[model samples]
Target: MSTVPIASSRSQWLPAYLALVVATSVATGVASWMFLPRPELGPLLLLCLMGILSFQIREPDVGLRISFSFLSIILLASAAIVGAFGAWLVGSVSMLIDRRQRRWTATMFNAAMSGFVGAAGAMVYAMLGGVEGSGTVGLSTVALARDLGWPLFAADVVACLLNAALLSGVIHFDQGIPFGVQVRRVLSGSGVAFVGYGIIGLLFVILWYPAGLGAFSALLVLAPLLAARWAFIQYGEELRSHERTIDTLVTALGTKEPAAVDRSRRAAVLAEWIAEELGLTPGQIGTVRYAATLHEIGHLGVATRLLRRSPASLSPTERRVIDGHCVVGARMIEGIDFLEDARSGIRHQHERFDGTGRPDGRAGQDIPIAARIVAVTTAIDDVIREPGAAPVVSIAEVARRLRGDPGRFDPDVVAAAVIALDKHGWPAGSPAPVAS
Candidate 1:
């Protein structure tokens, strides 16, 4: 979950939500101090230091607001070695010393959430018959596994669920995103990483006690963890570079018509929604976005005067030149490796479903799915932007127009577009009311 504080200016429930989390954490810490056994100072200090370092060295997560780190491994191990109060201390202190400058609300929320996760995990570990600290010293590997394995694993699951729940709560209150959606996103995005953290946390415990490495076990684990962070940084950079390339192309397209940029972005969003409704793969959805954004790029190849003129004023020869922009846009990006699949969509976006329209005249299912999606989405955007047309009225009209024109659009794609629009509504400024 994201450590960044969502702006609370418009959200009435966010401040109240943050206060509840902070208060719950304080109560947990107080109870742990009152009831749990005191932890060994030396090992507790070592874990606290390691936890602070883990937070500082977080890895970037592409397409997500949350940062990733091996702090979970440290927290889980601390639950076993330091007892509940010590675990809470380690988590709280680590956040208090965080070097990143942030709003006080964010700092408080993160620290409290971390402490709560630690204390809860430690409590679960103790309840599940887990041995802590010197209790497992010199135990055989098999014996240690029998005593500590399931407890530590269970502790890890509790930590994962609690952390996701708390984070999802703040997001739901602050951004109005549904609670269930954020929870599912957390599981799908980082579920595997959490499982690996549990295993590594177990290994850290074994190294500290049975193998007699103690605090030095942290040093041995640091190497691979840092390497993984480096790899993710490179991946995030590559994704950013791809976005930069797409932006350059879109900016060039905007030079012909200033409104083209906004239209392209709106079309891309609608196309993505339609793609999701149709259950397309992630890669195919990405291709549809690219195709929608660059669908009008061929106009750059036409003369400025011809482009400025209305379609009704253009003679037969001029109209053909205007219509050929699709081919021109396709050729412009043919050498771009990442856009190879999108090229086909851009090349055929103007084609009619019945084979009566376009440079290639491909009909029905013969047309690429990405092209069909772009056709319907762009048409909707065009209709919505017409002078004096109400957004709600335009949406209904566009849905009817697409459904009624079987020869112009794929019937299946039109149906998906209509459903997606009704479910999610249109983008900001277009204010489409959801169908009841």
Candidate 2:
């Protein structure tokens, strides 16, 4: 099994990404010259402005980011209804004028890639038996829908794939992250938005055929367009708010037990490595990371006196008070809809494999897999961080303890952790494994 370091880091792959951008730009430019339509200054300028106003929407929780621009919808529709050349002109101009990309190289690349995407989509539409120009005027709604819908959908798919391929390639090279993971994140994050925009583009095609890009015709779409943009804005705000709340909680816990918080973060990194090694889905890995970070959140509710006292001298009641933090943390986050999966792990991180530990005593595979992973990772992190309590325990020592401790942790999880630890070049000596 291979392990990935969970720390966020980047490598220098700018030259490579820039080269790709240049290649794509030049290739698309040549293709555009061969097939793209002559410039239509009026609609082209409007589309460019719309593209400029469009922003990139990002949701880190789902590891997704996408550019949300009405210009794209309008341009795609114009491509299907008017011709590919108009879309090429508008998309190319918009990319060049995009002020957000400060670097000339990036700006040029964006323009080139977008122009290519638009051109490719137009070609696809034309190849799919789509009517050109005013020919779309006489078709019945059903005929238009059938003729236009599939081609538009296919074009949309091409646009998405091209965009994703270009961006994901850069990310993969620069960050050394998996390409599939980056692609999945990008698509999942914007899947609904992209589909909605595509549908809107189709609507634009239908209206433009009959109405001729007049004020009244454009006005017809304003309500729905505005509604869609507003919905996206609201959704972005909600995600940001949710993220802020998580940060606040983590900060609060850090204030209460700085070491514990640090330990939690380290555990999260290790757990991510183990989860990936175990072939968990990206979504599941995200949940594991969150759970690991908040695994010790229950410690925040423990009394200062209890924290200060040595564990060896703690009374039974004191131990119980300490042990109940999992339940407390779980309860605290149970109401949070986004943290639902995390809450389960937080609650069961203390549970043992042999029906002997925690609030619920489930044995072996009955325990939540996430909780089991967290337990193993947290235990290992605790040992690694412990100071002067014991001589630096070796990875072998850690594995030995896990193997020796009968049902304290899941063996499979423990095995994964050991492999990850070894693969990450975990220090030779660390503290003995701490009790969960």
Candidate 3:
């Protein structure tokens, strides 16, 4: 549904990939036009206009660079109404009118991908005996369902899968996200909505042909589509607000403990990688990210002098007060509804695997998983940023250091961190050789 632009620096294979997609799309469009019967000009043009309009109305997604739009429904309806060539035409032409400024490569890639997805869906529809262009007028509901329903559903499923694959392919190259991870993210986030879109497309087809409503069918469906878009826009806004709140808290913490600003963000990145490596659910992954980012927020309540002092110089009483920051941080966000699950993580992040850690001495798996992951990630970040440490620590050295601590950290979480760091390497400013 979207095409992310690759950075110019990492674009070695991008031009070749875009060229291949565009070429494949053109070949499919030409071959379908040459072999298939032409669809009616009126319906074809109307559907193309609908497709263009749908593409223009897009909502930003929080988890992806891609935007969500009703273009899929239009593409599905085009496949059911107009055979392969017309569907391809609708899709390719829809990308020509964009409101946002974008690179030529992005436009070309999106147009080509849309065209391919449409043509492929239409081909699947035809292969399953779907008749195009006003052929459903005389059939009873049962007969219509038999001939049109299954084929359209199959085509819809194929279109969704093909679209996800194409989008994932581009994202993998552009953003360095593993293709399998991107695919799973897409499926988990939008699979149900796609099924709903298929049903909407089917209704549009039924209204256009069987009920003789023609283009008015589009108008009839416009309200619900816009309502859905509006709802998602609101959800996106709420997520942005949550981000702003986190920023405010982080900024406040930075005022008291400047080292925390960058450390929290770095810990967040590492924690998310480790959570993914451990195959945690997406919701749990999000909680881990939040916990890691705010793990040191307790520093806000500690004295500035205490935080600035070297660890070896701190008195036991002062250290105990410093340790209570975890508890203090948990209470600070207790009123935040969305952060409720993260409270336990912040509260328990200082807990050790061997039951000797600060405040409450909860050990092993008795500690929240988010806390355990955050503990390892924050330690990794601390070591990477440690004063007098090597300019660039190797992954093996980092792993060795983690293992050197023994029962201080959760062994499983430590292993997951090592594997994740080895596979992905550390982020910028914390360079480490990928482990062999």
Clashes by residue pair, model 3: none
Q: What's the CA error at residue 52 for candidate 1, in Å?
A: 2.2
In the range 44-159, model 1's lDDT, one tens digit per residue, is 99999988888787764543366666778888899888989988988887777767645778778888999998999999999998999878787777878767888999899988
Write model 3 residue lDDT over 6-124, tens digit each, in one string: 45524466567778888999999999999987778988999899888877877756355566677778888888788899899999989867777377777788888899989999999
How big is the positional error of residue 190 in model 1, measured in Å on the Cα after superposition?
3.9
Worst 10 residues of 1 by lDDT: 1-10
Model 3 shows how many backbone clashes? 0
Best by TM-score: 3
**By TM-score: ranked, best first:** 3, 2, 1
Instruction: State the lDDT at 321 in candidate 2.
Output: 99
Question: What lDDT does the true structure give each of the candidates?
Answer: 0.80, 0.68, 0.81
Selected candidate, larger lDDT, 2 vs 3: 3
Summarize candidate 2's per-residue lDDT along 1-436 as a digit string, tens digits: 0001122324466566667666766676566667665545665555555544442321213233344455557557756654676666566776666444556665666666677667777778888877655667778778787678788888887777766666666656555445676666556556556655788777776776654663344567756666766766676677678668777888898887776656766777788777756767667877888888888888888997898788888999999999899999998887788889888888988899989988888778888878999999877766666556455677887788778887798888898888877656452333434342
> Of 1 and 2, which scores higher on lDDT?
1
Q: How accurate is candidate 2 locally (lDDT)?
A: 0.68
- Per-prediction TM-score to the true structure, in the order listed: 0.76, 0.79, 0.90
> Which residue pairs come into collision in candidate 1?
none
